[model samples]
Target: MQTDVPVTDRTRVRREPARGRYDRETVHGIIDAALLCHVAFRDGDSVFCIPTVCWREDGHLYIHGSNGSRMLRALLGGQQACVTVTHLDGLVLARAAFNHSMNYRSVVVLGAFEAVPDDRKAASLDRLMDHLAPGRKHEARPGDANELRSTTVLRIALDEASAKLRTGGPQDDEADLSLDVWAGVLPLAVHALPPVPEPGITRSMPDGLRKWAGA
Candidate 1:
């Protein structure tokens, strides 16, 4: 779905000019690949950024944490927040130090957060798990009333979201082109490791997971 995030010429933050992408597809693709988000919100005079698991469903993003956390409590108080998710693909090592950079995809959402009602909390939790590990929610233990009571789920509508991305080689200045130095990005990606089954809980890892682990 197309986002309502405005891409006014003046509103663009001037840093990495080529890195900014306004297209929703590119933005959402990045969000889907990452499992964590950093939510920044202000409480009184202080600004706090908290890292937490997030899930996107029906054009809204959901995040949860301990009910007693000051960050969640502050968000429940109806504070405006900036939630961001970023994935660093590689380090851009340039011949010139000034041209050094990194390839990344990131999304920034600014909105007013609200406390999800109790009725939808369980479903929200399910979405979060599915976001992190699809189909695993049904296979795992469901949260009990006590566990639910200790958690706070907050939802932020994806209406006002903006995504920016950077890729490709380093951009060295014309003058710096003459420098005798190796200059290129060292590409990086998340490599899946062999699944180490929980010591006491092994029912033969699922085939799909075993394949992922080269079992």
Candidate 2:
């Protein structure tokens, strides 16, 4: 697990090289912390990037969409794509405007997508549900045959991936450090809000939802 992934021409980090990480842990950590990803792909004269829910397992990233979705259809056709996930930890304020930045972790994955076979779609869907909300798949009814058939799941290997991270206070110029200006980090985080049960459901909140929300 400690092995370093190869840095190919496309995966190399040229700017702020010190912030780039190619190891499995860094890349996977960023991916695991994120629940959504932006996927970009090119089709003919148009370039499209769409935000979608994502999950990872066994060194592969999974995304699901309608079988008739343009993005899914393009990916299922073996188009190359880029997937990116980012976590904004805080906003870095500096005495100098130029030094203002963000404390964050981000990952970029480059690869071609392949459709998950019909036999494996169900399990993948379960994994996705669990990833987003632990224990959800078990508590909810399983997808029916028609539902399964109408959905498309695609996977991309986490092979050509890299994570870039920034942390701590901004590095203001020596002169700016002496300036009388407010400088600090405003921390941010994503947390589950209290659950709002669906209308007409009289049962108590499920253990799964409560546990997932840490409530």
Candidate 3:
């Protein structure tokens, strides 16, 4: 059984409370399925939201970028941030336009960011590569000293988070359901394409690539 995350003022799901999910399994599942996340934070007097690759390991969510990046610098300075990951499953078409909506699983994480220690930075980078392309990390060369010094990895503990999901067919009003119009869900999903190797590559395709392609 999974435990629920304590709901705080910021983590509360206000609209469609029935769609809210606080269980760790559900929240982690959604986070794991997403390849990218939008992180929102305030800088001085302006608010910024930037999209970047994100991965969860152990109990923390990690995102990396060039050391010179404003976002990374700000995060390294201990600024609070909000990260969101969403997967669109389908488009729900209802008889009435107002009732039309999307089927999606989304997670919102609110917390302060912390920089990964220098000693653990390499391992964190490896985990990130594996998360993006499992098993590929072993085949690639590790980051050099300069590269490691030029990059920044920030993490936020998964202490405050919530997941919201909306699934199933369109829910049109009773009167609209009887109208002469199509009302259903057009399912959507992400498909991995066959891998394309770089020019002059001599090594055979790895099992990881094959598995990722569903070959």
Candidate 4:
């Protein structure tokens, strides 16, 4: 059933209330569109915000790292974490310097991460490979038992989350609009360049590999 992510005290958007969003569609889309997220969690007396690969499946967001990693170890221990993903769509230029802004899509998720059971770890990792390049999981060599044992896969519920976005042109002041200056939006996006294959020529590039960088 289609639903919305409920807003909690921490997940609530305080600035520019009009830009806040809590719909499931918006939240899921924003998460899926980004390849990485910045996870903020406290470690001892210091706070750390580290960027890592993130993917969504069902109602949970997933991340992985080496078992010895401090950040992964802290999160898998059920420490509260705040994950954020952002997409900069364009630069909103205005006639007034103070009015200049940016158009972006961002999502914030607050929850404690949990370990994925050992039995389901491989399948979950495969899903991540598919996310980056469809069918690539089958084409590439799979992780062996030792490799899987040394890795830690964790997931956090997306129950407490919100999406905030800004779109279109700038909202310049009435008085500033009359100024003799160029004002508009300069759009931006993630452009996939031609793929660069490895130096060794054992075989041709597979369809799955081509999709990875839009070759």
What tens digits encode model 3's per-residue C-alpha lDDT throughout 1-215? 23388888888889998898889888888888777999999888999999999999977889999989999887776778999999999999999999999999999999999999988999999988877677978888889999999888999988899989999998888888779998899998887775677999877777665434531
lDDT of each: 0.78, 0.87, 0.87, 0.89
- Give model 4's TM-score versus the native structure: 0.94
Candidate 2: tens digits of C-alpha lDDT, residues 1-215: 23376677788878898888999888988888777999999878899999999999879989999988999988887877999998999999999999899999999999999989999999999998888678889888899999999999999999998888899988999888789999999988876786677899888876654534531
Residue lDDT tens for model 4, 1-215: 12378888998889997899999889999998888999999999999999999999999999999999999988977989999999999999999999899999999999999999988999999999988878889887999999999999999999999999999998998988889989999998877776567888667666664543521
Indicate whether candidate 1 or candidate 3 has the larger lDDT. 3
- State the local distance difference test value for candidate 2: 0.87
Model 1 C-alpha lDDT per residue in residues 1-215, reported as the tens digit of each score: 23345665432546756556666676677777777899998888988888988877777778888988998888888877889999888999888887898887888877888888998999989887676556768888999999999989998976677777778999888988888999888988876686677779768655433322321
Better by TM-score, candidate 4 or 3? 4
* Most accurate candidate by lDDT: 4
TM-score of 1: 0.87
Residue pairs clashing, model 3: none
Q: Pick the candidate with the highest TM-score.
A: 4
Superposed Cα deviation of residue 82, candidate 1 (Å): 0.6
| Residue 199 in candidate 3, Cα distance off native in Å | 1.4
Model 1 / residue 186 / CA error / Å: 0.3
Q: What TM-score would every model get versus the actual structure?
A: 0.87, 0.94, 0.94, 0.94
Q: In candidate 3, residue 146 scores what lDDT?
A: 95
* Global Cα RMSD, each model: 3.2, 2.1, 2.0, 2.3
Error of 2 at 10 (Å): 0.7
